[model samples]
Target chain A: MDIRTLCLGILALGDATGYEIKKMVAEGSFSFFSEASYGSIYPALTKLTTEGLIECRQESQSNRPDKKIYSLTEAGRAALEDSLAKDPRPDKNRSEFLASLLFAEAVAPERINSLVQDRITSHKRQIDALKLMRAEEDSPVGQFVLDYGIQVQQAAYDFLIANKGRIVTKL
Target chain B: MDIRTLCLGILALGDATGYEIKKMVAEGSFSFFSEASYGSIYPALTKLTTEGLIECRQESQSNRPDKKIYSLTEAGRAALEDSLAKDPRPDKNRSEFLASLLFAEAVAPERINSLVQDRITSHKRQIDALKLMRAEEDSPVGQFVLDYGIQVQQAAYDFLIANKGRIVTKL
Candidate 1:
């Protein structure tokens, strides 16, 4: 999703600063499905505010810049619902590591072996995060989503482990 | 992968017109892993030619605009290999549907159900495409890549099918 729509949806749940929105995406259940950098998030918030879909309150903080807390307006809630009703773009799993593996013959045997191990390790980490998030959530949908991520990541790790020998030998 | 590097890689494989390059990406094994639009391709080709990384020749057609057939130079091959040697960026999957699903309670019942069905159908189609691609190739690496796509996509489809009813009822 575009950062603008994502910010609006997050605000619909509760008010948050721009930093909080980025933090939520990076560390929350949303991390696997969606992500936005500060560069994208800050600009999206400014545009959403100008469009009047969200309202912001500047709160002073000790030893820090004033935090801009943004909340969804009624229009923002409506917008979020409307966007949800539309057909979403297909999910992308654009793994550079997987793509690089296609050219494994070009790399050294040791390099390819290390790359395969790294991918399996990373998948394991994501699976662990998904489990933790699933534990913390009550929403049936959230649980369902986490379950999907866990299964897919685990499947990938298994495939890597099972096939690593041939791939390494060929490399 | 960025469009510029993708274009470079395709040229490294063989000389091809811009239209041919687009067709390759649309229907080739690369479809599963990367994509680029004409908006990015044409400009990239123009820049590459100016930088001496590629050479383009205009071939006039019967009724269409002249086609530019681009070929990679020695410099281009070196550039591509250099890019391959660098640590590639991590893969990123951006899904609007999953993000919206996290807020299923906000959307209409019919919309949620239809969206789930649509997403499931899309992933199934991708899995089918990957299967067809697998049958056309005999290399172990190609087979592995295609199977990887299938494993991940099927997992996604199963998750949606299993959870459809819960999302529909809550919507």
Candidate 2:
């Protein structure tokens, strides 16, 4: 989905500033399945406001500049529901690590070993982060997604540990 | 990695026509971890040719247009090796299915069930396809990657089957 549709969905959860929306995309629930940069988030918020799907209000702070907080309008809620009702496009997983592994024959055994080790470490970090999120999640839907993430990452970690020897030894 | 670098790596495996390279990206080993469109692949091939990293040779075919085949040059091989030696970016998984699940409360229970069911079917299909590829693969590295894909898809499929009730019942 485009960042605009996701922005509406985020606002549906609660009113948020553009920075807060970016944070959600980066580190919150959306981080598991979606991504948005500040560049895209700000523009999407602006367009949504212009379309009257969302309303933006200026909120003053004592030490910081005024922030633009966005709330979903009725139109925005309807739009989000419409988008969610449609068939979502299939998942796209682009892994540069896997792409690098495709050239295992070209690299040294040391390199291959290190790559596999690094990937295992990364997956461990993700699983740990998801576990923290799972503990904090109260919504049943939210907990389900977090558990799914953990399961998938754990599977990957197990597979790597099991198969690392096969690739490295062959090199 | 960019399409140009991946093009070099694909050519390093064997000489292929632009069409063949595109096919590999769409359906072959690269399909699991990378993606490139005709629009992007053609331009990447042209740029690589200009850079002298790869060479294009036109083959005349009867009753059809002459096809351009691509092969890695010495420089191209070196370039591929250099790219492989560098660290790759982390995996990026953009799953619309999971994103839709984030708003499970916004949709009907039947819709959520169908979405989960559809995702399970997709993952099953991917696992079957990967298994077919796995059987045909002779290289250890190729098999390793295929197994990785299968294991991951199976994990996702299993997760959905086990958790569908949790979300649907909550709605």
Model 2 per-residue lDDT at B131: 97
Residue A121 of model 2 has an lDDT of 96
lDDT of 1 by residue, B23-88 (tens): 777777777777777887888989999999999888898999998899988888778766666666
Error of 1 at B2 (Å): 2.4
DockQ of every candidate: 0.55, 0.74
Off by over 4 Å in 2: A107-110, B107-110
Model 1 residue A88 lDDT score: 83
Worst 10 residues of 2 chain A by lDDT: A102-111
Listed in order, each prediction's TM-score against the native is 0.87, 0.95
Query: Highest TM-score: which candidate?
Result: 2
What shift in Å separates residue B74 of candidate 2 from its native position after superposition? 1.0
Note the Cα lDDT for every prediction shown.
0.78, 0.86
